[model samples]
Target: MRQNLNYSYPQIFWVEGRPNLGTSCPSAPPIAPFPPPVPDRRRKPKNHTERRSVGLLVTSLLILLALTGVGLSMFRIFHLEKELAELRESASTERIPPALEKLIGQKEQSMKKEARKAAHLTGNPSQRDLPLEWEPTSGHAFTSGIQYCDHGLVINETGFYFVYSNVLFRGSVCSNQVLTHVVYKKNPTLPGSHVLMEDKGINYCMSQKTWARKSYLGALFKLRKMDSLHVNVSKIALVNFEESKTFFGLFKL
Candidate 1:
């Protein structure tokens, strides 16, 4: 026996220092060394067309916006040009011939002269406990369809009317008297005047001092043609006939 033995293959087992080369483990395959692990320098998109598509979409949007803005600008310019043309035409046609201008001026003057007046009655005359009379030409007195005739308003047309009246009662000395104000409607058809509204004032003022009080009445009534309306007071001597404080009016609805 040899003191030492040498074999090409690795010995698997030994018995009493003798080498047994019948079975041996196979050597692992050699792994090639990775080339130092190169750091990635070039960038890449996961999808090949991703970056290109995004850039193209941005460029397309910009182009579309430019086109839309250009279209809107052109449209606005066209609309403004059309309006300018219309204005120019209107300006050109605004002038009238001299004869037509005179006629129009005369027509305007006539219309102004014939302007409708309101039915605002504010005027004079009444005795104590008597029907009041009004002056038609003074203190905002005007008549349109309602005629102020002989202390009464005569309706020219049949329709509903709003009648209003105000009476101011005052005295130098307070006299606790019952002051009555009444508005009546009369016509040839009725025997007596029909009372439309009335107001009574009792103990209205302080006992010793001079006092003033107002009675205002307004109402809507269905009146007929030629219906007459009048205002009456119980004590006319105590009435303050200030135009601003006392007025009667009827307006056709």
Candidate 2:
């Protein structure tokens, strides 16, 4: 026998002898619709404006820290400068000692006196007297610290002086006798001329004919203002009148 079957309903399957419903291998079971997807509850995505605002806040904080550091450095520098200026001002106010100031003034006065007094006088050959007086040469006399008057040098300041003189004596014949040289000073306090230095030369020449001799006298003496000095020799005619050969000079020491 032949039979027509319909499969419109798949839940039921007909076997060779009986119709089966809910068979394990005849058809698949119905599938329930998928449940809605669960929402992500732990984290939320940030918007563009929120991200920009957070970055701006961080940038502002960093700028504020940098400016504070700069201000602190500048304040330290200014304080140090103020301290340095105060130190300088204090140093400027320090005082010098009175004794030192007086000493300095005295030294200045001494130097001024030294600058004002010096004299050098040369000799003239044509003069009289065995212990002859000397006149300053016409064009060769030097008077800076003192004055020259009539064959004498006058002091202008009271101080120690280095007095010096050079005399050249020559003759056609040698006497080899005693040659006397004297430097004398005349002052208001003394009655007559006082000798400051004296020298006597004996046997100074080895030759009997065409003999020549030279004498030099120099010494330090305390002289007063208004004192006058002169150079005197044993023989006037024997002395060389050459300005370079004979000279008398004194300087304040």
Candidate 3:
């Protein structure tokens, strides 16, 4: 019965008024196994790059510390140097010692004394004829034989005079053997032997005792004008102890 096909029925490709999308769609082609979820792997880090970064950091720190230490030391050194310079400058401007000033004064006085003496001696025409004797001090007593010395001054009762010659030792002449202090020795004939002038030779009244050789016989003449004793006498008595001979030489007067 072609009767009344008017009854509404769902279309094959449409559901009600909307078209059907695909309820099963052939199972989506099996999804290719989802490519195993792409393995979820992570990329490896650059080991050399990381190591180099750490090393660079450490080296930079070390250099920075070293620089800091050096800078500090340099600063301290500069500070100390400035202080030392200031101290030296201050010292340079400071006053000298009083003792030093006094020493300078004494030296000037000595110069004046010498100048006066030289002027007197130089102008005196008869100075050559005047006898020069060593000025003796009041308290000091000359020991045995007269000795001339090149060094040392003796101040005694008379005045200040330099010794003519050093004392001569027996057998040989030695500086160590030079007579210095003087003392007296007792003898039956001479009564007592006297020693005087520590380093210079001794003089005694005893004529029996042998006299030592005089090294400064020449100096005796120069001293002649110093006193009134023997200004005209230019000859000095020299005794050769070894040969037991007595001789005389021209005086330096």
Candidate 4:
């Protein structure tokens, strides 16, 4: 059975002004905050006169350096020139003097005289200052040591010489060898340079036959001219104008 409703229900009306508490619409998107403003930087002020003055100062420094280098170079050049001039002057003043030249000449003469005397002592005593007769001035018997036989006086030392009594042979033949000697002659006006020997006669050989006979064999050397005489050596015969021979010998006084 339907019983009449006696209880009263609470009424809910939909109003536009207020929303329901349980249900909610999407919240409006949160707004982004504005960015902070950047501050302007301050620049230093320029001075035109100061920039020009600094440029001038740097240029002046460079110019001063160049000038200093040039001054040093000039000083060095002047110094070198002065030194060269002094050297030239010194050389001119130190040249040999005339009086000194005379003294040198005298000394040279003295040396020559001594040398001639020495040459006389060695052997090949020149006949110019020697006696013709055999006198034992050299303390050695001329005949005892005489190894060569010749036609003329063989000067061995200044005062001593060998004079052969007779000539055996004065001719030349073919020889594979030869001997040489220096003959000294007086260089008149030149002190101590006097001497002469067979060497002075070498160019006189007209033919090979003459050379073998006239060639200055070792034994034929004058005592004083022995120094000038070279021994029997190889190739001497080659230069020799003489024809080839097996053996050759020279005898002296």
Tens-place lDDT digits, model 2, residues 1-253: 6676766865776775667775576455768999999989787876899999999999999999999999999999999999888878867986446897799999989887777688777776677754445555466776776888767888878889999998888888877578888889999877988998888889877776787778889999999989998888887778887888888988887
Select the stronger candidate by TM-score from 3 and 4. 4
Best by lDDT: 2
How many backbone clashes does every candidate have?
A: 0, 2, 44, 33
Model 2 worst lDDT run, 10 consecutive residues: 129-138
lDDT assessment of candidate 1: 0.81
TM-score of predicted model 3?
Answer: 0.28
Candidate 2's displacement at residue 124, Å, is 1.6
**lDDT (Cα atoms) of all candidates against the true structure:** 0.81, 0.81, 0.36, 0.40
Weakest ten-residue segment in model 1 by summed lDDT: 110-119
RMSD per model, one decimal: 10.6, 11.7, 17.0, 16.3
Task: Please state the error at residue 89 of candidate 2 in Å.
Answer: 32
| TM-score per candidate, chains pooled | 0.54, 0.54, 0.28, 0.28
Task: State how far residue 130 of model 3 sits from its true place (Å).
Answer: 14
Candidate order by lDDT, decreasing, is 2, 1, 4, 3
